[model samples]
Target: TVFLTTHFMDEAQALADRLAIIADGMIVATGSADELIGAGSTNTRIRFRLPETSQLPDTFEARRDISAWELETDTPTRTLHELTEWALGTETELLDLEVTRRSLEDVYLQLTAEAAEP
Candidate 1:
């Protein structure tokens, strides 16, 4: 059995067959990367940008700049489908779109944050 400790979640995910998260001098959680990430409500994250001329829908939580917008969603597949349809309907260009799963680091942070709460 190898006992290792580090603050780097990415390193833990990469090196460990089983991962443990310690917080406040206690073992808060333990699992593999997939297990930990799957336990969360948000399994997927979608990020995207639309053209400056495009109008953002009220359902989307987005941050806008001069020429682009960024947004994240928990349901990537459904959201992507809806977004694509919306883009087609609105005649907007979808730019800089990225879809990713919730990382081990995100799970670690969420667990630690919850542990810190009273």
Candidate 2:
């Protein structure tokens, strides 16, 4: 039963049960954090370190880091399952496995940016 407005995205994400993004005096988007981020544009990144000789399937658009490889995908659940299965099958040790999801701020920026576009 409380209404609050702030330019700080983290504050809104932390305190609000529901969120609405206003751009050009119009409500461009509205939803919970997960809903807005999961809609269509957001991507989850999977990062891991593996033996240099071991390679992932061609479907993964992997980029090599100093010691880790990373890829962004919309279907993280399926990707993780396939990755683990591949690791098990190849006897490859996955190191520093991390999943990074799009944040509320990212969604906010995207929504606002789209609204600004002609």
Candidate 3:
């Protein structure tokens, strides 16, 4: 058995054959990706197509702390709800304002990375 710890969340996700995380060195969560993803939450990616493809307001929902949002939800429905709201709010002159499920890779990248690390 390998007893290990890492500062990189990606590293934690990668080497985590069966992950057990401790926020303050105290066990807080434990599970595989699916288990953790299911048990914890997920984010949604809102992809929008503006009227001119440039008219898309870069601003996100400030009140929701969703200006360019990246937050976790207890269920997939939660993300969908926020996505719908976002789309409706932006559909005034936009086309294809839709929400997509945030992939595991997406979360991994967002949580601890900007670009892929080597």
- TM per candidate comes to 0.83, 0.65, 0.46
- How many clashes in candidate 1? 0
Candidate 2 clash pair list: none
Cα lDDT tens digits, model 3, 19-84, are 665543445556676665554344554544444433333444322222233334445475556555
lDDT tens string, model 1, 24-76? 88889888888888888778776667665668888877667665565556677
Task: Write down the lDDT that model 3 would get.
Answer: 0.50
User: Candidate 2 lDDT, tens digit per residue, 52-117?
Assistant: 788877777688878888877888999889889889998999988999997888788888899999
Residue 79 CA displacement from its true place in model 1, Å: 1.4
Best by TM-score: 1
How are the candidates ranked when ordered by lDDT, highest leading? 2, 1, 3
**Which of the predicted structures, 1 or 2, would earn the higher TM-score when compared with the native?**
1
Q: Rate the local accuracy (lDDT) of all candidates.
A: 0.81, 0.86, 0.50
Span of 10 residues, lowest total lDDT, candidate 2: 33-42
Off by over 4 Å in 3: 41-63, 66-118
Candidate 3 root-mean-square deviation in Å: 8.0
- lDDT pick, better of 2 and 3: 2
